[model samples]
Target chain A: MATLNLSAVTKSFGATTVLHGIDLNVADGEMIVIVGASGCGKSTLLRIVAGLETPTTGHVAIGGREVTRLEPADRDIAMVFQNYALYPHMTVAQNMAYGLKIRGTPKEEIARRVDETAGLLGIGPLLGRKPRELSGGQRQRVAMGRAIIREPKLFLFDEPLSNLDAKLRVQMRGEIRRLQQRLGVTSLYVTHDQVEAMTLGDRLVVMHRGRAAQVASPMEVWARPADTYVAGFIGSPAMNLLAGTLAEDGAAVQLRAGPLLRFTDGPRAGGEGRPLTIGIRPEHMLRDGDAIVTVALDLVEPLGSETVLHGTLASGEVLTARLPGMVPAVGSNMPLAIPAEALHVFDAETGRRLDA
Target chain B: MQDAVLARQAMARQRRGRWLAHAALALGVLIFAFPIWITLVGSTHDAATIGRGDVPLLPGGHGLENFSTALGEGGGRMHTTPAAGMLLNSAIMALLIAGGKIAISLLSAYAVVFFRFPLRMAAFWTIFITLMLPVEVRIIPTYQVIVNLDLFNSFTGLTLPLIASATATLLFRQFFLTIPDEYVEAAQLDGAGPLRFFRDILLPLSVTNIAAMGVILFIYGWNQYLWPLLIINDRSMETIVVGLAKMIGSGDTQNEWNTIMATAVLAMTPPVLVVVLLQRWFIKGLTETEK
Candidate 1:
């Protein structure tokens, strides 16, 4: 296991910059998931760390050794590609043993390791089959097995489950997490799917426009995102953002969305008469009469375990409330409540969290 | 009843179309086969019998005499005419040229497709430009270069100049381009260097292209005439094409139609065998390329 550190890493293709200065320090044996939207350079960052792509500026160190100029083979790292880039000509066993064979490992030892890794992956019976003979999930497992057999210092997964179907993606995600835990190898995973980042990361790095927005544990990022982008990108169904102005009333500061629903979060010294965006997660909103404003329902989506109610406030601002059960139907009026502490205040112009 | 009649009319039209297609194909095959048939029949007739212009509609029983005369039965008369050495010389030169061309094309194509260096694009275009320039245009200059290298009238002169054909390089480059980049990336991650990557991954994947190019190169080298004739002036160094020329050059009164036809038949053997043997890969190469 090794810790990967990137210091002031920047990448540019011709004149267009893909990655701005990125600084991240992954702890030894830590599984850090880098989450971002497409073109956010998450995959490029992983490739840079894997030594597949060289940074236009800055350095990459694995286990305290600078490897910015090293080729991928010299980096002592293994990566599982999204397409499961297994050699089409090789059997499952040969695919797993390929790295060792290239390294000049003994044939018997290669076979033994292949058998052992295949057994661990529960693909022991498929040793002689080529990659085309295996299903999508099986090919994914083989790709993982190939990496595990190498026992490299770091494991890089570039959206490994993105090609699989939803059910298979979930299953393979669990399998990967379990395997990583069992081996305790340092890992870096890049994905656009926030759920994979949330569930798989020991620490999550939320990237925006090629810069790291926040780097913390999954819960920390969920509860306290660094900015409006991180807050909106991290959670499912997304957080609801309403544009308003922060107004001072006595000793408390209140957010006025449209003079109907007001959110007061203690007293603020500087945020007065300034444009602000108030953020609240859908799960945090409740269907209670204790709220400051009553809302009229516009749509309801029942998702078995939890129901999502989409409605408009008296101010005509759209809001969503994820409730525990089926709530009011469309066109019905209901009162909505949000805890005062759950409100996330952000600068309207900058999109930076005001309370952060 | 009206619908049935219309259906029947359509069926009859389809049958007529099929008959016309068969007829066209038969006429095309006959046009192609007529020359070979004439050559075979001509080989069995005595010179006087052929000159009489009443060539038989069946075998004339002069096949053995023509075969023996072409195989050197005429002693000093036909035996020392370079026809016999032409077969062995052409076989050696064609095999060497085919082997060298395949080797060079594969190496050049792999380097062009997989590696990056300065002037790579220039080199690719330079080689590709030669495809548009026929060998006939460069025969004199190529002959001078070969002679300057002291390869004149030698096997090296005959084979080396024809070793670097653009057709093979183009075919191989297109084939290599179809292989996904993932394989190269995967091999790189597995500790394979460029040489090993080319050998283990790219070469194995390009078997069909190599075989197809090898067949084409063999035929092109085997059928070469003007350059080999211009370069190799020695009687012993003459290829089958040059040898066929000498047969037509001997005094018209002494012309041996039977032996000339026998030599023609022998000359066609190598290219025909090459195509027949590698037809499977040739067909696969053509079909796979369309995808």
Candidate 2:
């Protein structure tokens, strides 16, 4: 097990910066999932840790040893690529045994370790089969088994589940989580899928434009996003954001679309009449709750267990609410209520969360 | 009833098309095969019959006599080096040229594609420029160098100059570029240093390209005419192609036409056999390596 630390890691391609200075300390055996849209530099950060790419300026320390200049093999780490880059020519067993063989491990030891890892990955019957002969999931397992057989201090995964089908993705996600825990190896996984981030990461690093938007536990990031980007990115159907101004007493918001929603959680620090951005989750919109707003229903999406209602406000701004069942018919300007205490308050100019 | 009539009409049209296609195909095959057929038939006649300018269409009674004379007793009336020995020499030259070109080109292409050093592009372009100068163009200079090095009549002189192949190197370099960057990173993480990676992964994956290139280079080396003729003045050091060409020297009246035709057949057989035997791998290598 290893405790990994990155100190102000910054990377740039010529003049365009890809990863702004990022500082993070991953606890021993903790799985940190870096979640972001494409070009957000999550994959670059993982590559930097893998020694595939060097940060323009920063330090990477693994288990108290600086490996910023070491080669990938010398860094005591293993990485699974997005495409599952198993050698197409080698059989599954040879693919897994390659690292040990390169290190001059004894033949019997290499065979034993490969057999054990193949059994662990449930690919024992595939030892003689080439990668092209195996199914996609089987190839992914061989890739993982190839990494696991190395037994390195760190495990790096780059969107490993993206090639699998949805059900297979969920299955492999649980398998990865359990395997990480059982081996207790510090791991860093990067994916653009937010659900994978929430379910797999002990802690999530939500990145925006080149910076880590929020680095916290999944629940904390879900509950208290640091900025507007994190606020909308980490939730399903996204958290609804409305433009408004604070009432003179600072206890309620005067929405641009004409509604006064009180802040039952108490007044936040902001000048009276100052413009603000109000945040609330789609699932938090209730049928008849403490605070209410009028929405002209446009469409209803019944997702089996829940229904998502899409509507527009009087100001022509779109709004969505997730409720337990179907709501009223389309084109109706009906009032959807929400708990006053559930509102997230952010400043209009900076997009930073204003309420603690 | 109308649809049935239409279907019958279409079937008749298809039958007509098939007849035309078969006739065209047979004509095409005949155009290509007639020369080889003449060569085969001419190799079976007596020297006097062929010398009279009447090309034979069928095998004559002297077929075994002509082949045995060309193979064991040498095609030329007074020459001591048999066609069989010359054919063996050609085999050695072709195999060595093909094998050496592949090994050297693979190593050079690997170095140029995988490693970074000074003048890499310059080196690549220099190798590429060699394509413009075939051995015939630089015969005098190459011959002088070979004479100076005392390799004038050896297999080294026959194959070494011809083995510096730009097409094979460029083909290999292009193929190497198609290897995904991820495999290199994976090999690096697997602790496979450069040479080990080249041997264990890159080499095996390149088997198709190697086989394809081998077929091309073998035919090229086997068919070399002027370079082998210039360097190997000794009849014992002659290749089948060069020796056969010498057997028909100056005019048809003085040459042993039947034995010369038999030697030409011997010269062409090995290369055609090589292509036919490796055709499957050659096509697959050309088409499917990236997959």
Candidate 3:
């Protein structure tokens, strides 16, 4: 087990800087997931930690030892690539035994470890089969087995479940989490899938552009996003953001969509008449008779037990709401009540959260 | 009724196409096999009969005698080497050239594709440009170098000058480019050094390509006539193709035509055996590159 520390890690390609000064400390046996949309440099950050790519300026310390300039093998880490990257000519057993063999492990010890690891992965019957002969999930397991056999201090996963089908992705996701926890190895996972990040990470780093916008627990990121980007990115159906202005001496917001909702938690720091962007989740839109704003329904998606409503405001701002039970028809005006306690307040210009 | 008629018409067209294909293939086989068939029949006849131009259409009882004489002893009235010695020389030269070409080309191709040293592309283009210069274009300069090195009348002289194959190197480089970058990264993460990765991963993956190139290079080496004839004046060092050419005298009547045919037949055997033994791997290697 190990703790990973990155201090002011930055990466650049020519003038195009990919990662801008990311600092994170992962506790022993903690799994820190770096999640972002493509080109946001999540993969580059994981590669930096794995020693696959060096940071432009930073230090990477694993288990209190500096390994910023070391080779990938010398860093005592293992990586599972997106495509599994098993040697095509080697059998599953040989693929798992390769790292140990390179380190001059004894023949019998190598064979014993290979068998044990294969059994743990439930791939004992597939020991003699080559990579092409295995299914996608089987290949993914073999890739993990290859990494696990090394028993390194760190595990780096770069979208390892991407190649598997949906059901298998979920199954392997749980399996990886269980294996990481059981092994208690400090791990860093990189994925663009928000669900994988939420389910897998002990803590999440939501990256935007080239910077880590927020680093917190998944639920904290969901409940209190640090900026408009994290607020919108972390949840399904995406949190709704509306243009507004601070009014009534920091106690209320006057939405551009014609709703003046007061903050129930506390007064925000912004003074009256200051521009702001009000945030609300799709599921938080209430269908009460006391309507604050009305939306003209454009499309109604009934998803069995619940329905997702897509509509437009009088100001031509698009809005989405997830409501329980089925809505009967489309192309009608629907009134939604905004709960004061559920609203998130951010500065209109900077998109930073305005604390009470 | 219309669908049935259309189906019958398609069947008739397919049958006609099959007939044309078979006729074309039969003509090609006959065109290639006629001379070899004549040589086989002539080897079974007396030398006087063949020399008189009354070439036999079928084998006679003298086949074993002619083959034994051609193999064990030199053809009468010709200063050519024995068929057995020429066949041995050809075998050694062919094996050496094929092995040397493959080893050197694999290393060169690996270097060009994997390593990122300065002027790597320049080095690759230099090798590529030599494909335009065949043996006849650079023969004199190559011969001068061989003479300077005092490698005349040796297998080294025969094979070494011809071993650096640009075509084989290009083929290997193309195949190496198709290998995904993940394999290299994975090997590095597995703690294998560069040479270890080459031996453990790259070489095994290149088995089929090597087999296909081996067939082509071996045939090219076996059929070498111009270079061997130019360099080797010693009869004992002569290859089969060169020795076979020397077996024919300017005066046709003085030549032992039956023994010459037998030596020709013996000269064709090793390359045929090589193709037959490696035909499956050669075809697979050329057709499919995927793992």
- A20-106 per-residue lDDT for model 3 (tens digits): 999999999999999999999999999899887899999999999999999988989999999998999999999999999999999
Ranking by DockQ: 2, 3, 1
List candidate 1 stretches off by more than 4 Å: A249-265, A292-300, A309-318, A327-336, B44-48, B55-65, B68-84, B289-291
lDDT of 1 by residue, A1-356 (tens): 99899999999999889899999998899999999999999999998998888999999999999999999999999999988888877789888888899899999999889988988999999999989899999999999999999999999999999999999999999999999999999999999999999999999999999899999999999998878999899887899887766565422234454332345545443545677777889999876634455668888999988998888876667888788977757888887776666877777788887652
Question: What is the Å distance of residue A313 in model 2 from its true position?
Answer: 0.6
RMSD in angstroms between candidate 3 and the native structure over all alpha carbons:
1.8
**Which regions of candidate 2 fall more than 4 Å away from where they truly are?**
none
Docking class of 3: medium
Per model, kept true contacts as a fraction are 0.55, 0.79, 0.69
Candidate number that wins on DockQ, 1 or 2: 2
Model 3 clash count equals 0
For all candidates, the clash counts are 0, 0, 0
Which docking category, incorrect, acceptable, medium or high, applies to candidate 1?
Answer: acceptable
> What would the per-residue lDDT of candidate 2 be over residues A1-356, giving only the tens digit for each residue?
79999999999999999999999999999999999999999999999999999999999999999999999999989999999999999988888998998899999999999988988989999999999999889999999999999889999999999999999999999999999999999999999999999999999999998899999999999999999999999999999998999994788888886778888778767678988998989999888965677888889888878889999887887889999966667777888886777889889999999873
Q: How should the candidates be ordered by lDDT, best one leading?
A: 3, 2, 1
TM-score for each of the candidates: 0.92, 0.96, 0.96
